[model samples]
Target: MKPLLAWHQSLWQQVLASWQQDHLAHALLLCGPQGMGKAQFARNLAETILCETGQACGKCKACNLFKAETHPDLLQVEIGEKSKIITVDQIRNFIQYCTLTSSYGGYQIAILNPAEAMNNNAANSLLKLLEEPPAKTLIMLISHQPMALNATIRSRCQRLDFSRPDKKLTLAWLQNQLSSTQDAQLLLNLSAQAPLAALSLAQDIKKRGELFQSLNQLVTKKEDPIEIAQQWNKHNPKQILEWMNSWIMDMIRYSLTANSNSINNKDSIKTLQNFAKQFDLQALFKLLDLQTEAYRLITAQTNIKAQGLLETIAIAWHKN
Candidate 1:
């Protein structure tokens, strides 16, 4: 069995304590920022409950079945490859699966990741199941943006918040994971202190640096906004928007307080300070709003032209 993550240790203890006291809830909502390993936590919990030893012993028959992805009592629901939203039919099937007896005579488990991806019909269908859960069953809803989920749905499940860990804990953990301590700090900053996300950002570090340089060129009027937009569109526009948002936020913070600590992009402090000096608060806010809207549209899967959207934001930045 995989060892539980250090940051997840507290939440895991809470779960284990609840299970030991027979006070575990029928449904749990794992809500937090993305890349916090909530899905892994849910799976570990499920495996523990299903195992003969009441722990996720890898040698057990149930554990072996789970490892092989053939566990009859475990169901994972997510959006389809060709689709953006989890449909009502999928939820209905999950509910049906829940009603059956556990094949191993253990707890039946279902995990719905990014539960907010469910449309109205699907969400409402899930509500019914939440209202009347099956015996000896557990339902876990994983959401990065819990507010986007139905209020009624949110209220029903016990919430387990997986926020970012302390910076020291994260930095120490990251340093152990990566070769360079300097890279670890930068990755942690880039990922907003989410360790798992920072690890994933390692490969993209160079790309992020290049993008920052491009933005710096745009700020200095050394690059064309249109051409920069084209280049950005060739990569992940959504991620670019996120990076832009972060930088803009940092600029605003530094402008208002003149505090280096307020800046998340500490490595680019000088450039961001220069950016803050050029734009007034209102201009920065406007640009931030534009990036925010573009990000929202992309995440909503709206039929917006990526290049056009990026171009507009880029031009706005250039004009400011």
Candidate 2:
């Protein structure tokens, strides 16, 4: 298995200790924010558990099978690209797989990534499995928002929280991954201190810059809302909304505190300051409420018309 991130070393050791003592939980919830690498941690743990030597020896048959994505004993369930929710059918299949004996006579592992993506019926199906877990099985649920899951599911699984890490260690690790010229602190701030998210921003600087430029143009009345909406529709709506939310929050912070240093988007401070002065406090609150609802709708439903939502949000920005 690939090694866990440096910040996760202690947690990994703890899990190993539990396993060695035969006290490992049948169901584990790896809870953390997005981009915190919880899924990778889960995968590493699974590999170690499934390895014949319990060390994830890269040359072992089990390790080869796992790397090839053909491990008979490992099943993964997640929302498909065309669908927003993990359906009951997928959970049912996982249950069937659990009924079988492990091919390698080791652990039968199932990873449900973004576990909250499972619909009510799917979650209920999985809950039954959790209630009466099979022998030598490990069910790992990787969740960005554990609160979105059923309380019963949350209660059944032992949690491995990845929320907080030593800031100095994280910053040091982040610095090594980024180029010397990049501002690690600024990237961290933009990503809310999620290292992987910060790295992604650094890697996609051009796209991020373009997005900020579009927002600046919108705020200055230099671009049409409908046109920007059309352009953004081709990209991932969730990411678009996230960036917009961050920018709006920064603008609001500048308005309330008159402290540009406190804002997340330092690169866009001047633009935010100029825009913040023209926005009404009540209107800003209304926009925030609208964006929250938009995020809810996008997350809860499949095949949403994000263009219309973006256009509406854009028009709201222009008018404010």
Most lDDT-accurate candidate: 1
Misplaced by over 4 Å in model 1 are 164-167, 181-183
Candidate 1 lDDT over 1-320, as tens digits, reads 57787788878999899988999899999988887888899999988988889888888899999899898999999887646688788899988998898887878999998899999998888899899989999999999899999999999999998875666777788888887635788777778678888888887777788899988888888999999999999898888888889999999999999998898887889889988998999999999999999998887784667898899888988886
Query: Candidate 2 vs. truth: CA RMSD?
Result: 1.6
| Candidate 2 lDDT by residue in tens digits, 1-320 | 77678889899999999998999999999998888888889888888888888899988899899999998889988888878777788888878887778888877999888899888998898899899999988889999899999999999999999888767877888999988999898888777677888888888777778877887778789999899888878887787778878888887888889998867888778887888887988878777877877888897788688888888888888886
Best by TM-score: 2
User: How high is the lDDT of residue 46 in model 1?
Assistant: 87
